[model samples]
Structures are given as structure tokens and as C-alpha cells.
Target: MNVFEVRGGKKLQGEIVPQGAKNEALQIISAVLLTPEEVTINNIPDILDVNLLIELLSEMNVKVNRTSRSTCIFKADDVNIDYLHSPEFKKKSGRLRGSVMLAGAMLARYKKAFIPKPGGDKIGRRRLDTHVIGFQKLGTQLDYNQEDGFFHLTAEELKGTYMLLDEPSVTGTANIVMAATMATGTTTIYNAACEPYLQQLCKMLNRMGAKISGIGSNLLVIEGVDYLGGTTHAMLPDMIEVGSFIGLAAMTKGDITIKNAGINDLGIIPEKFRQLGIAMDFKGDDIHIPSQDSYTIQKYLDGGVLTIYDHPWPGFTPDLLSIVLVTAIQAHGSVLIHQKMFESRLFFVDKLIEMGAQIILCDPHRAVVIGLEREHQLRGITMSSPDIRAGVALLIAALSAEGKSTIQNIEQIDRGYQNIDTRLQALGADIKRVAI
Candidate 1:
């Protein structure tokens, strides 16, 4: 195991660039399987989860060429379908949640797919109902193997149909959309996730010869094409990291500038941090978060306590709620964080409480954070990272605490963020990686 030894109370400065969107990369990289020709992808984040997915693809005989650390050329001309049933495939794919996406691309082109129970962050119940039902609606036959613990999917022929998703799940929508792209007729998906990453997937598919309309809306209509071809794609900057930097700047009283932040694609992330009274300046594609001694939470017009909740696209993202919650620790006022999407994300706040932050975990999905107002500095202690987002949140708290903090299970953090400790060190953060 590896741990991060973060010496807190040192202000970070200098400019940092956010890596390619991890969410977008997962969907985009999986989409490469839809075509046989060379599909070049640029700005791929060099992170664990994405690399695991790429390695899974390579193991399936997808020809992969690394043009650079951020660029790759993939040709899936001769993917070995039998590999999907191999024990090696199950072991590798089971460890990666993104592996489920291969089912959509495989089922669409190969008429068959198999996936074991996928693994990811243990945040809450992330069900595959939407993907399974959507595949069934498209005339696919699904069977479950109890002993092997794999979902077996096969389709003699896929026929496009209408589907109203139970919830607007991003991955579920991407999987269904990929499957629908090659169906025989038109497919319409309502209540689809319209996050920028999903939109990027739709646009990338269109570039690859799939006719998809409603680029930035909940309703998506796809005119099924006989086959998709190869196309080059560039990933958007990771908005989650941009938001994390905003929170980091405020908490550590640091002057940090994030380059190529994809501001327009960030949706409501910047405004949410602004609601926390964190001042920022937008310079073209960059976001500059100025150092601040303290920030105040904004209240409603009628004088109600401010409430920040996660919603679908165009609303505050659930991923950043943890960052927002931690950023408010030294703020001037209080706020309520409602994590409606995930049931167990708020459980990480206990670590912050142990570090001397004032937080009340209302329930599984809600918490109230009363700002410390900088009168008290958080004291560092040993903690373990629970999930990717919460892990980064804990790291942020550790950076702002008064003493040295040891963070274990940092592998969870590396799964999402690319070279986080090294990146933070560039901005003058006192963080180092050490093996246990």
C-alpha cells in the first residue's frame, strides 16, 4: 500500500492544468470498439481507471498505439470475441466499472457480449437495470449465470426502440446510446443524461458516422446507421478537477490558476464555488482562484440557510459536493449539502470532523457544515480514503490543516486524478508519496 504524507498550512501557488476528463475518456475510449479503422484520441488522462480500461481493450486484441502520453491510436479490426469469456477478461473487467461499456459496443457490432459484476467506488447502489432493460428493448436476449456471476447478452438482431430511463444515469445512457447507434431503426431515449461528457460522446459518435441529434438535451434521438467508421477525438478538460482546485485555493488560501478549464462545458461548477464566496476570474480558457483568508456562504433571498444539492446536467454535479463541503470548513457561514444521487458519499465527513471541522451528518444523503471562520485551524491526523472524490476531499483538508497528515488508500485517489501529489507539488504543496 502507498500513502500520502501531506504537511499542511503551506499555501500553494503557480498554475496547474487539469487533465482530460476521466468520465469522458471512459465513454470515448469504449466507443473506439464500435469501429474497425484507426481512431485517434488526444488528451487522454494517464490515470489508473482509464488505463485499466485501455489495458482491457488491448488484452482483447484491439490494436493500440501510444502516439504520446496523452494521445493514442486504436484499431479494433480483429478483436477476439472469445476473450470476453476468458477468466483473464473477467478478472480484469470485474475490477473496472467502465468495463460494462464494452458490452454496448460489443453487442452492437458483434451481436454478443458478456460482463461480470463490475466494480467501482463503493458509494451506493449503482445498478445496471437501465443498461440491461435498454438492451432488452433493442431486442437483445439477456441471461444470467449464477455460478460464474456474469451477465450474458446476445442479440440475433438489434432493433431500435424508445426508452424512458428510470433515472438519468450517465454511464447507463452512454451504454444504451452506443448500442442504439447500430440498431436497424431509429432510437429515442428520454430523460437521458445530458452532461457535457455524454454530449461529447454523442458528438463523437456523430463524427464517426452515427446520426445523433439533440446534442445538449435530455431527449436524444439516434438514426441507426449500418456501421460506424473511425474518427479522431479530443477530450475536454476534467471539470471535477477544476472544481477541486477552486476548493483547494479557498481552503489553503492559495493563489492558483487552472489552465484550459473548459469553462463553458463546466456547467454550474464555477457558480457553485462562487456561492461559497470563493472569488475567481475567468481568463479565456483558464480559471484563476485568488488567495483568500475567508469566504462566506450565500443564503437564500428569503433568509433560509443555503442548500447545495446535486441534480442532473445543468445542475451542480454530485461529484463536487464533497469538495464543496470540505471547502466550507474555514468559511464565514454555514451551508447544507444534499447529495441526492449517492447515498453514502456524505459518510466521509467523519474524517473531516476528526480533523476539527464542524460538520453534522444529517443522514446518508445530507450534511450541514458550519464554517469555522478561520478562527481555528484544522489539526491533521491519519485518515483513510473511502472513494475517489472523498479521497481528494480528505487530501484538500489535510493540505489546510495545521500539522502533518497521513492519507492511506491513496490508490483510490490515483484512480481518478492523474499524478495528484506531483501536480500539487508543482504548485508548492508539501505532499509526497511513500510506500507503506
Candidate 2:
């Protein structure tokens, strides 16, 4: 196991570049299986989840070449379809949630796909119904074995039709879109997820000769194509990490500039941080957060407490709510953190409370935070990470606390953020990664 020992009370200053998008990397890497030509991808984050998915692809005999630390070329001219049925395949695929996306590309090319139940953060009940129903809409037969926890899907020839998803699930949308690209007719998807992750997938497929419209909208139309070719695609900067750094600068009173943050796609993240009284200067594509001694939480004009909640895309992302909650600990006023998407995410507030913050866990999905106003600094303590986003949030909290803190199970952190300790150390953070 690995742990992070952080000596707190140091102000981090300097420029930090956010890693490439982890969420988008999963979808884009899976798309490479749709074609047999060389698909070159740049700006790939060297993280555990993506590396594991790439290993799975290699195990299936897909030609993968590492051109650089952050660039890879993939040619799936010959695939080991028999490997997908082995026990080893199920064991490896169950390690990461993104493994579920392989079914889309596999089914599109081979007319069959099988996978064990995917594994990922245990934040909530992440249902696979969206993916199953979307595939069934395109004339695919689905079967599940409850005892072994495996999914079997087969299709002779997919005929595209209209599909209205129950929710705009991001991975669900990507899976369905990839499957529909080679169908026999036009496929229309309503209530599709339009996040940049899906948008990038659609654009990449379009470059590879897939007919897709409605790139950044809730409705997508894909025309069936006989074949797809090779293409090059680059990933966007991770918005979640950008939000995490913005919260970190506010908590530690640091002057930090995030370079090449993909400013236009950030949507309401910068404004949402401003709602918590964290000011940011946008200089071109970079976000500059100036050092401030203190900041005040905002309230409604009717004298109501401020509430930060998550919604679908084009709204505040749910991934950064934990960071925002921790950032509000030293603000001037109280704020409500509503995690509408996941139930178990807010349960980690008890760890923060142990570190001398005033927090009330109203329910499974809501918390009321009363700022200490810098009157008393938080005293760090030993804690375990619960999920990827919450793990980074606790690290931010540890950076601003008064004493040393130890965080275990940092593999959860490693699964998303690339070289986190090294990157933060470059900005003057007192953190060290040690083996336990």
C-alpha cells in the first residue's frame, strides 16, 4: 500500500498544469477498438485507470505503441476475440469501471461482447441498465448470469432506431453512440449526455468517418457507416482537477496559475467558485487565482444560505462538490453542500469534523458547513480515502491544516490524478509519498 504524509501550513505558489481528462481518456481509448487502422492519441494522462485499460487492450492482441510518455498509437488490425471469454479477462475487466465501455467497441466489430460486472468507485449504485437498454434498442440480445456476475450480448446485425435514455448517463451515451456508428440505419438518441467526454468521442468517430451530428447537445443523430478509419485526437484538460486546484489555492492562500485549462469548456465552474467568494483572473486560456488572506461565502439576496449542488452537464459538476465543501471550511459564512448525484459521498465529512471543522451531516446527500473564518486552524489527523474526488479533497484539507496528516489508500488518488505529489511538490507543498 501507499500513503501520503503531508506537513501542513505551507502556502503553495507557482504554476501547475492540469492533467489530461481521465474520464475522456477512458472513452477515447475504447474507441480505438472500432477500427483496424492506426489511431494516434495525444495528451493521454499516465494514470492507473487508463494504463490498466490499455493493458487490457494489449492482452486482447491489439497493437499498442507508446510514442511518448503522453502519446500512444494503436492499431487493432488483429484482435484476440477468444481472450474476452477467459476467466482472466473477467478478472482484469472487473478492476476498473471504464472496462464496461469495451463492450461497445467489441460488439460493433465482432457482433458479440461479454464482460463481467465492471468495478469502480463505490460512491453509489451506478447502474448498467442504461447501457443494456441502449444496446437492446439496436437489436442486440442481452443475457446476464446472476451467480457469475457476467453479461453476454450478441447481435447478428444491428439496425438502428430511436432511443430515449432514462438519464443522460455519460458512459451510457458513449457506449450507445459507438455501437450505433456501424448500424444499418440512422439512430437518434434523445436525452443523451453532452459532456465534453461524449463530445470528444463523437468528434473522434466523425474524424474516423462515422456520421454523427449534435456534437454538444442532448440529442445525437448517427448514421450508419460501412467502415471507420484511423484518426488522431487530443484530450481536453481535466476540469475536475482545475476545480480542485482552484479550491486548493483558496484554502491555502496561494497564488497559482493553471496553464492551458481549456477555459471555454469550463462552463460554470469558475463562476461557481466565485459564488464561494474565490476570485479568479482569466488571462486567455489560463486561470490565475491570486493569494488572499480570507474569503467570504455568498448568500442569496433574500438572506438565505448559499447552496452548492450538482446537476447534469452545463451545470456544476458533481465531482468537485467535495472539494468545494472542504474549501468552505475557512470561509466567512456558512454554506450548504448538496451532493445530489451520489448518496455516500458526503459521509466523509466526519473525517473533516475530526480535524476541527464545523460540519453537520443533514442526510446522506447534504451537509451544512459553518466556516471557522480562520479563527482556528484545522489540526490534521489520520484518515482513509473513500473515493477519487474525496481523496483529493482530503489532500487539499491536509495541505491547509496545522499539523502533520497521514492518508492511506492513496491508490484511489493515483487512479485519477497523475503524479499528484510531484506536481504539488513543484508548487511548494510539503507532501511525500511513502510505501506502507
lDDT of 1 by residue, 1-436 (tens): 8999999999999999999999999999999999999999999999999999999989999999998989999999999999998889889887788899899999889999997988889899889998999999999999999987788999999998989999999999999999999999999999999999999999999999999999899999999999899999999999999999999999999999999999989888988999999999999999998989889999999989999999998898999999999999999989999999889999999989999999999999999999999999999999999999999999999999999999999989999999999999999999999998
Worst 10 residues of 2 by lDDT: 143-152
lDDT, model 1? 0.94
Residue 135 of model 1 has an lDDT of 94
Candidate 2 local lDDT, 1-436, one digit each (tens): 8899999898889999999999999999999999999999999999999999999999999999988869999999999988887888888888798998998888888889987877879798888899999999998999887876778899999899999999999999999999999999999999999998889999999999999999999999999998999999999999999999999999999999999999999999998899889989999999999998999999999999999999999988899999999999999999999998899999889999999999999999999999999999999899999899999999999999999999998999999999999999999999999998
lDDT of 1 at 141: 96
lDDT of each: 0.94, 0.93
Question: Could you estimate the TM-score for every candidate?
Answer: 0.99, 0.99
The C-alpha stretches of model 2 lying farther than 4 A from their native spots are 146-148
Clashing pairs in 1: none
